[model samples]
Target: MCARIIRSLLVVCASLAVAANASAGQVQVAVAANFTAPMQAIASEFEKDTGHSVQASYGATGQFYAQISNGAPFEVFLSADDSTPAKLEKEGQSVEGSRFTYAIGKLVLWSPKEGVVDDKGAVLEKGDFKHLSIANPKAAPYGLAATQTLDKLGLSDTLKGKIVEGQNITQALQFVSTGNAELGLVALSQVYKDGQITAGSVWVVPEAMYQPIRQDALILKKGADNPAAEALVEYLKGPKAAEIIKAYGYTL
Candidate 1:
């Protein structure tokens, strides 16, 4: 009787260990640079609410897309534009029909110097600044939006010589914040807090100036079988995640 009881206890312990190991597995995510802060916030809450952890790599969405196509081991992708995920799904790199818009982002022309940027973004027209930084239009969705806005305003040709391009939106913002550039076109969420600009002058570009930045999230083919990745994707669409995203100046 005693031997049977001990064997039953060992079996239960082994099963419990397996379950714990599965719950502790991490989800690997590739996130766009523009969504850096929000993704960090979301990842923290996700890890706390669920025992699953997330390891996130942040960079330009275009670069991530290229990496994914080349078989990057990311389980999830949070993009700065909806198109990239849709393209990935079409290419069969992402789980079929597993992509969805997580947030809508805003573009802003910003200057760290007080009064350097105006509400109407006339600074771009004035062209007084020595340098204007923007992300590489070919590699970043926000950069593409900035390029579109400049084209819409007929400043593309005029501003060509004065433009300095960064690899990603985060780098573009760094150029402005560090005074490497007098002004920059960057993500609004990076400079906003409590419905206001934080320590900078910002012109929130009108939506009509460029295409809407509909950010999307996708479950990659590598993560289709990962429970943690699927749970994180669902969490991003939940009420808690929406609140956090909205707090960062993003729209649902």
Candidate 2:
């Protein structure tokens, strides 16, 4: 009698597991490097609430655009700049009317070592550092903003030889964290938490110095029929994701 009851319980559990698996879906996402932390947190919450899983690939937005254009399998894209998604929509690479601004990014000049950067960002003009890191301006919007800030401050030509370029914003932060570069111009979301810089010294770049970094999210053409893709897009615009984005210091 005991063995029979145990077997029956096992069968019921298996059936329930199968039902759960049948309902759950997965979405592939291409994310910008700067938004990695918040996206991961949001993805976790999204999965818990919706029973859907997210597979995220992080990199420069320009590179992701090229890949998506060439038919990459990503169902959704969270770009570092609004212009990239606009271009994709214009070229028919993304689902029509599915794009929206998700977050506005902030740039910062930071050093992992305390006191290396000042609140006023006078370090660039002081020229006390050997290597200053930034993302590749051609591929990363934050890099373009950094350049713009430098130009506005009249320090671009003066600091050219001292600059070291990273492939993306994350790598640019790494260069500073690892001591390879004494200072880096990187996305604020990379180091901020709870309305403060989590580590090191930082100078938050003023918005007037550069173009606003308007990050956008959209479903790709390939994701038109994927329910998980549509769900994830809506989730990003929901209250839960907005809280997470704000906690990471991104303006939603």
lDDT against the true structure, per candidate, is 0.92, 0.94
> Which structure among the candidates has the greatest lDDT?
2
Off by over 4 Å in 1: 1-22
TM-score for every candidate vs. truth?
A: 0.92, 0.95
Query: Model 1, residue 61: displacement in angstroms?
Result: 0.8
Clashes of each: 0, 0
Kindly report which residue stretches of model 2 are placed more than 4 angstroms away from their true locations once superposed: 1-13
Model 1 pairs whose backbones collide: none
What tens digits encode model 1's per-residue C-alpha lDDT throughout 1-252? 999999999999999978987767699999999989888988999988888999999999999988998889999999999999989898888888789999999999999878888889999999998899999999999999999999999999999998999999999999988889999999999998667788768899999999999999989999999999999999999998998899889999
The alpha-carbon deviation from the true structure for residue 171 of candidate 2, after best TM-score superposition, in angstroms, is 0.8
Minimum summed lDDT over a 10-residue window in model 2 is located at 16-25
Residue-wise C-alpha lDDT for candidate 2, range 23-71, written one tens digit per residue: 8899999999999999999999999999999999999998898899898
